[model samples]
Target: MRRMPTRAKVEMAAYGASAAALAVVPSMEVLPAHAAAAAISGGSLWWLYRKAKTGDFARTIRSAQRLLGPVTGGVVYAAAAAAPGRPWWEIAVALGWGGVMAAWLPVTRSTWTPPAETGGPGYPPGFTGLVMRLWDDAEVAPGTWLEDIEQTVSPEHPDFTADVVALAGKPVPRLSDVDIAAAFGVPTACVTLADKPGHGPGRLRLTVAPTRRRGGGIEEVWAEVVARPGGAIPGSKIVHVKTFPAQGDLPARGMVLAEVEPGEVARINHEQLCSAFGVKAEELRLVAQSRGREALVTLYESAPLKGARRATRELLTLDAYGRYTIGTAHDGTDAKVHMQSAAGTFHGFLVGVTGSGKTVALALMCAAWALAGLANWVTSARPDAQMTAVGRHVDRQGAGAIFTWWMLKAAIALMDIRGRINGEVGHDFSGHSPYPGLVLVLDEFNSLVGDEALGDEIAQMTDVLAREGRKFGIGIVFAGQSLNLSKLGGEASLRDQVQGGIGVVLRIASASGGIAARQATGGLAGDVDIAEIPDRFNASMSLMDRMHGTVDDVPGETTQGVGHTVTGSEAVMMRTLYVHLPKDGSPDGLGEIFPEGGGINTLTEREIQELTELGLWHDWTMPPPSAGGDSGDAMPAFTGVEAGGGIGTLAPPPVAVKAKKATVKEQVLAVVDREMTAKEIRGLVDAAAGTVRNALSDLVTDGKLRQVDHGVYAPVHAPADV
Candidate 1:
């Protein structure tokens, strides 16, 4: 009395009709019953076999039924034919065959179908599934290679187990961040993530879409809960997914999903992303952005410092990025330097250990200023130190501190005088100033700031200068082996001010292996990591190519100047220019002052001509600073090139001397009777970039004169005020 399936009911009805036909029509008995039985059996077998092809159900039984149907029908015919009128035998065979069909009937069912594969990777089965994947050699798929195994493999191959690795331990078709996110029971777009400074993982609105099974076509997803990772991403909370159109280079337009909230992207950094994808450390770039924590990422084809650039006059203005570049970030864009503010209110702090290119940094910045028609006021406690190079191009030497109180007094006097001039003229000059701004390069800050006798005064001077020199168009740049807030001076702390200041900190280091890596990059310390640099002791191929298109253009170990600026909270590696300074002896004995193989090298004939044309190069043999070196006509640079060909070979240039008996400083001090200014004394002495200012300063230190006001100095005999 049970209701049968539709197919069963139809077949049953047909069977009854057929029975009725045979019984009702005696003449139909002439129509063979065996033939009718054979037709019915063939149709049933064909239909059942088609059902077997679609799903896993009674496969063996279907074939048996196909064979049995014909055999039983034939048997029925045989019994009827062999013994005519023994129709009971044929009836018994037919009933038995029908009973067997009922016992062997199978139901239709669908098997597991996996979802589509994603670019990141797919969710793989667990360890149990891995063990089950082994197959015999014959059953292995063609052209499929087992990873990490050099040869073809079969299931549970003995040799494979012994020799195979996980291909650098990265699992293929394994659960990835994308897969895990998708498995969160929602449709989500998985964003690839990595850790990086400046631009890295940050807040992003990701549309989370659950991933469907691989190879599953048009199948409904989210039918089951997604399997989450054994360990969740730290601090991440599940958010509802959002569907979007195809964006950027995402895999599909089908269901662009965002699975996380904004700011979630920020948490994913270069390291995390690399580990997740099993890629190398540098494959991704979190390039510095003009604004925002979300910087644009780009892949670089090659090293950013692959080439070198020289400092040129055209690169002198604010329109350009820096006084000179240190190098480039991993991303090939210029690591443009921002040394100080427009008002010269800030200072540049170059922090690096010895051999890390501190001197190179100094020269690069100074050279840029010198080339731009800006003044370079450099100083070193040591006269013969490498810091002397920048002063070579200037009319007067820019070095020599001597770790004495006199040194501090001279600096204070110099800055005080310049500060007053800036106050009078104001910082808003249209064209350039005779001294556009003072770039006071302190070579050994520790030496001066840590000096036993003058350390405190020097420190105080540093703070005073930093506090007040900016509006007066003067900026300070400190470089030394040892640096810290205590060495910087001032009662209140300036550590935060310097660290979180408006200046570029060129963080430098060069250790290929070990702990340097751990301490290599971080906030304010190393925002950018400088990869391998061209030899600082030699000219690089890029430099050569830039000059002559061949190594022969400018050969030898030309010093390299490389670093990274942690300005604006972002780090960018940079390669500063190889500045060209006059050779051996310029007016201030400034030429050839940097380390033999440092940021500033001796000017070649071609470079000398270029700077000479701009009137930036000095012809030392023509006159000394005490003479008319600052105001008189300069001889061609060629005339000053030493005959020995130390950067040049030429005869000495012409010169003129006043033949005055008094020393230059003597004349300057004599004129300070009624509070004479540097320029007034210079005119009285008839000298240029003359020794007057220093003479006045020295006389004050010697108690022979007093700094009455600003640049004016009064002799001991003068009035109290002037």
Candidate 2:
């Protein structure tokens, strides 16, 4: 140690003298005065000590050492001034004066060490020692250093943040290069990294909110419970503790996600998981593993879906993003379905086993679409389908008419759109009114598509519409137990095309069905085992529980619409909006959805004309009144005299056909009794160019009239237009 300077020696002497005086002053006073002085001095010191412990003051060893002189002098003055009945303000003033002097005392300005000055291989002061050690071991950017560290104090589960700086010739450490929880000594799922907004680059915020372990052995207990006859794999550990929401004043429920060492996942069963988590077997759910390396251990306090959520009409309306809320997600968040996205309109596939709420979900979606101004045609295998609530809003229903209706409507729409695009009359179609969006609902799709007579053709037509219809504002919805390739005509790619919009997998009845759904959805439904969903929601009655009379009289609420909705790569658990449940004597759910007199979507007169002119229209489908006949084979009545040269000329009709009505084609030919150009004939007949041209071509093909000139047609018997 170096010799002390004279000035330092003098300061040390003054501090000693003041402390010694403070000790003697109390004893030197009279008994009553001494007692009063002692009380005043002791109370002040006690308050300071409490505040210091709570971190309200900078009270380190070094700081206390430096502050000793001022503290002793304040106590002495306060004690000496304390008469038996002295005013409280006198003691307050003395304490305040002492605090001012302490602040003015020469001491180191910093309470914590700066990172740069904390040289050598030692960890920075105030940092968690474990974090520094792991950071070094991980080699997270060798030449990078941490600084400006911030930590949450006294938090139930704490978070830490630091600014990263690079040394000469080294890059800053990035968050992706290191697993935050591994390096930070917390659960992987407990670690979250976010950018510190407005802090510029190289600033990372890490939140490590591990669920506070109970009995200080949440993991240790879990490990002991899961231990095998031999032992757990060396590296296996619980890597995640799921955080739960507060129920009333307590936590809702809890779970843990653990990484079972490779090859050990299969060895563990639901019993082990339940025992490990301290939950009953029925209350435990083994969520699907990831790459066979992890096991999700869940403990449910109640059914995930408590009860049926009615699909109110307001819930069917679209938001600005063209999305609508269908139900609540498993995490108690809103589950939304997008009608339109950046990619395009999404087609839907609703698949589930019987009693899985598939029909109710379909009804909900259809009603929503109708309210959103989309045209709907719903077909069901059952004649008494439970869709009466929305029955009025749909254009058609019934398996017999589905294929024909879809083909005609789709063909007409496609033709009209193509003509407009090719003719440059309009750009690509965007969904709205008049030509509102179109959806073909195939309810009980398996029964309808499995019919031997219609199956192959229906499959082929479905493929066509799936490929081409979306661009023209037409979408198809297939609802059934499975949308697997075999059910969809064994066309491997058809499911992908049709389900590009939304996929709902409700409670599946069998293991194979789950496998088929996994293949059909391409695992977009997350890795969920659909067969287990109903069991998770339904109340359980084990043999022992039943023998002991512990089972509820009424079992679980039906897990009807409880299923998964494919959002992206992950499938989210959700309950479909309950549109309606048919009753014996009550009215349909339609009154609960649509307004009293809300009409269904239909084509306008102009749209009708456009369809007819394309020759895509079928007689069995809607026909214009001008066609004047219901017969599919009705021909244009000829009003002409037969010419000798195989050319028939049409003058005006001498008499209208009284037996049957003439078609639009006959009216067009009648307008061309004399020589007339195609445009002139179109103007007189009040028809589109395409329609007039089609009529003229048919008449010419039928040998009713011959072209007299380049742009004009003449009656074959007329004398050269003289």
Candidate 3:
């Protein structure tokens, strides 16, 4: 026969010696014969049980053999202590026999020692060995271990299953560093750290599956995949699982849902979660919720409108409530602006630096208003550059635009009061036939408000229109580069009125501009950080790659018309649709929108008569082109009252008369509401520091200004509206 194994030999030796001790040790009588035999047997059996419980046995040891492990020596040594008659050599031999059996019988081997209550979960077929290996490798807890682990399968996803491990120490963060995907033979996306209710913070759960379980498709849904009605948002799931799609342009589209107390959600760090998930910090977003126990976390993808979106007539068409689609939001939904709600009308402000798509955004509004049967009058400081397309939709004007705007407001006010008095209408404009809504578009509006000679008059008129024109179906849309109230005629009330209606802040030119934009619309738009918005979608991406020395940078598409739109209490980052994209050979989208004599809205005789009575009426005609044919071509004009102080002109046919430029001293006085240095005044006004200082000195001597501190002067009188 083949040689017996070493373990078998050791077992034979241990059993033979123990059997001899039980049979012969009692006869030798360190104690009474019967008592000696019983003591030996009981002591030997206890040793065997201890070995088995601690995972020391070879697993092939029979209970009969295991019980005879020569522990008779230990029993006799104790009996000798009481007897005091036993030989020392005999006791020594008995003790040596007990030692040999203890060392030899429980073959030194490491067997799987699962927890006491629930041994362990049953791993998937062919995965038991790997799970055991990972358990030893992970060292989840040295002292406190997993208990009551159960194999669970998701009801919705047949291929998705997990081992719900119940443990005392939290293993969520540690498990993130572990190669869980390798242990379970699944794609990394399918492995998620999750929580279960009633488990307490001490325990964590994880879900995993085999790659084959997903049928070899990369975009497989995991056990945590939530079935939303339209995939618009990840609804709450009070289970321990992270929902992530396996494939996307980005690394992964994942959502983490946690059931937390009302205030605890604020403490959850999204950036830390992003780090754990191996995504950039900006990718994660904590969705705002009202009172709730669940906190939803998700990632924002790149904006969808990466290229020029052609303007279509259908998109320009306004709804019955005077809302029209301007572009797409970051969430891939349509972005709209409310020109007039059913309850009341609204004014709007659009702000961005040059080349930031300020004009493109304005063009969208103009086209929409034209389609909605509103009379839109377009005017601009830099009129010839980007105002051409918008001009094609309505009558264009320059210096006389403000005068015309005030006259139109008066006409609408007359019409509104007349209708209300006659019981022909309610308090609000009806947005119908003869008294159609009107929009006074003021492009580069900052230039008008910043003009020292006429800024106050324009601001006062604008404030009046903003306050009273809404009830009469009249609105104003101001477009500019900044939202500085001081630059906007220093009227905080005007800023408040424009913001109450609609506000769009595109890529800001300066940090201060961004702060002003964000602060101004904070109530309406929530917490959109316009200052952090990139100039282009790919701008940061390219910069980052170059900084890391891996980029051969290519030109990227602009974030033109990309900004936040605030209406009522909601705001969304959006990209405005292109109204005039020259690269696409559709330079003039307004032509397609109008398709007629500029779609101009002429004044009704009734309204024109009201203007005549107010001394604001001029002949509605275009004057003959001048001999030089360069500058004196009369633009379309309507009868309007002429205001004073270079604000308007007296003409049979209302002609464009340029506004007066302020002198250095007047400019200096206009800006010095607070203490400012000569250098600061020179920076604001296009004048030398010496000239600014001289003007400041003259004003201080005249009592119109005062020196508050060294090199600092403030206005002596409160700034008044001209």
Model 3 per-residue lDDT tens digits across residues 306-385 = 55566777877876656788886654567777766434655787877877887778777777777777777666654354
Highest lDDT model number = 2
Q: Cα lDDT for residue 347, model 2?
A: 71
Off by over 4 Å in 1: 1-292, 295-302, 316-326, 381-385, 395-408, 418-435, 489-560, 579-722
Q: For model 3, where is the 10-residue window of minimal lDDT?
A: 282-291
Ranking by TM-score: 3, 2, 1
TM-score of each: 0.38, 0.49, 0.50
Candidate 3: give the clashing pairs. Answer: 195-240, 616-640, 616-641, 618-639
lDDT of 2 by residue, 611-641 (tens): 5553333433332122235665654533222
Q: Give the TM-score of candidate 2.
A: 0.49
